[model samples]
Target: MANGTGVAGASAATASEGAFLEVAGLGVTFGGLTALSGFGLNLEQGRLLGIIGPNGAGKTTLFNLLTGLVRPTTGSVVLEGRDITGAKPHVLADAGVARTFQNIRNIRGLSVIDNVKVALGLHESPSLLSTIFFTPAYRSGQFRTEQKARTLLQLLNLDDVRNLPGDGLPYGAQRRLEIACALALEPKLLLLDEPAAGMNPTETIELMELIKRVHREFGLTIMLIEHNVHFIMNTCERIQVLNYGQLIADGEPSYIRKHPAVIEAYLGAGAHDA
Candidate 1:
């Protein structure tokens, strides 16, 4: 449910305005070691951008920096033209940024629908006192919230699991639930990390299609951290390559596949052996 507040129209807004997330000179450090250095990109409105590299390439760390999960050592992160460098996660969410983790973190005690309700709750007002008093506005707010929750569940085809406890879901369904929760926030920029980690090949293909549909229909600007080269290459409009926490390549999938340095840094051994 969306809390009767304005929704970002995630599937359609970017397709038209064509301006979305922008990142520049992004860097991150841990004590003495730099985990991410000078990473940057301009994600066009409504485009799916893939981030890929070997396991330790700082892919997810970049995500942490973007979502305020970690503060950048230096650089700027602007979303929809607003400066949000080092903004709190909730502040970022209120400003139309939402994310799913490398691991799902639904409220294990709540049902699928309740988990989504929490996202919608972020925008709901009328206060605990108002809710306890059952004022007209509170009643209306509750109604709107329920409607929004139902709509989001149906949008993600999780309506059947609405009543089921989040911890009871199958692996793939749990992943989708995390996405559904993020969508409930109606964020303009959606960050998905390892979305296909536990999916089977069939599930992977379907997940790719689902992702495309979400991006195209919702007008979402999607930035994903994924290891599946086929999934990344087939789905993203552009891809950024990271290695040892440094910016190594940035281009379309086709360009990246043929990049000499990229091949040398990542797929060189396999290509040479072949």
Candidate 2:
């Protein structure tokens, strides 16, 4: 369902590089309409990539395809050289993919730390007999899990609010907590969908610092979809632009800002008019 023009060329060029994460000829169609077509990119390990476009540019649709929320009509998603196209969300999580949504998703009544611990629990496999008998192995494993959760909270700057209910934290902190929970999965690739949707200028600035710190400290590869152009430009090493479900441009921050298609997508052809 792709336009069958530049997108094929883009996909070939991307696949030739053989990066850590490769998406080739990815497409999705609904009835007769295409939500995303020939969407492709190759991401190197441990780098930050940003995706930007106007609303309905299919940014979120791409995320859904990557995370298995939606199945693509065409193309393959390969991570670390393994084809994982159409894998279920949980299966992808087990294979080292973790994501935060555009909307905040927190366990309302759970403590900030408990929320993280809940996710961390997915990694442990203590025996039911051990749990029923209160065996040292189970108890020690639980303690270790809690300790790991606290460490993750500390890493994300949420340790001070560990005991507070997740919903009680400030909005910015809630976003960070979501990242912390995602990290509990020990993912190699992290997808953040509008992580700074409702922050003040100061908070946005802080978030920029936090994202860099997390990337540095954990050596994690991150992909984020954001409407905040300044935030994305300042934080991401590489940027990809989408419009009408096609990649208009992909390059370093400087190149993306100067790209004609990207500029046109954000501002109409007559944008320079008085």
Candidate 3:
């Protein structure tokens, strides 16, 4: 339990202790159905963690709860030791949390660079009065925002297609474009939901490296939900397996790959021996 595996019962007093992100006793119920239960985690800064599970295991549900799309019925979420249990999505974005979706959400008609610019505009827009007159300060801010957006585009290797429509890119590039938009937010904690869901082996490998490079360059704390077991095993430092919305195993990739509970949930009884 050194990795805080069964810490769903962790006391509130210790919830904020030395963790960049912490969740204790987190759960959600939709009507009479429990989507997640007693899920807890403590993620240190600059760490990469993966969440894996069979279908309907509540992996995406957890991301929604963390990103303010869904309010939890129980527990608290602490980031940098501040409680943010039920904050709104925009509030969470301002507090340094950003996420990509399972489906590509690029704006259809916007150019690739403009897609990222939209996120930058959220925080970098000049005053309304300055905007009306196109003041020097407004012009300066616009220049800075465009520069930053281009940097993000280059980071994701989409600069070559900067002028193309967001929805016109190939499937893999579209996924990366979504990531570029998320990066424009300058987030501290980045949640990636199935970044490799629709890729061939080659594309998945490329995305895996891209994610690692981003993590290294930005010093970001990343938590991803991925179904590609090979990608998760290689990219993440730690893995948490969920079964029926509950944590069945939490540890290094090697341990999680061989855990009994994980084997049973993912492959059925005795499948590990087969």
Best by TM-score: 3
Report the error of model 2 at residue 97, Å.
1.0
lDDT of 1 at 110: 95
TM-score of every prediction relative to native: 0.90, 0.91, 0.95
The local distance difference test score of model 2 is 0.87
* 1-274 per-residue lDDT for model 2 (tens digits): 1122235434454464557888888889989989889887778899999999999989999988988999989988999987889999888888889999898999998999999998897798688899999999999999999899989998888999899998899999999999999999989899999998999999889888988998998899999899999999999998888899998888888888877777788998755342
In model 1, state the lDDT of residue 155. Answer: 81
In order of listing, the candidates' clash counts read 9, 0, 0
> By lDDT, who's the top model here?
3
Question: Candidate 2, residue 157: CA error in Å?
Answer: 2.2
TM-score of 3: 0.95
After superposition, the stretches of candidate 1 with alpha carbons farther than 4 Å from their true spots are 1-19, 268-274
After superposition on all C-alphas, the RMSD of every candidate to the true structure, in Å, is 7.8, 3.3, 1.7
lDDT of 1 at 248: 77
For candidate 3, list the clashing residue pairs, or say none. Answer: none
lDDT of each: 0.82, 0.87, 0.90
Ranking by TM-score: 3, 2, 1
TM-score-best of 1 and 3:
3
Candidates 2 and 3, the one with greater lDDT: 3
lDDT of 3 at 152: 91
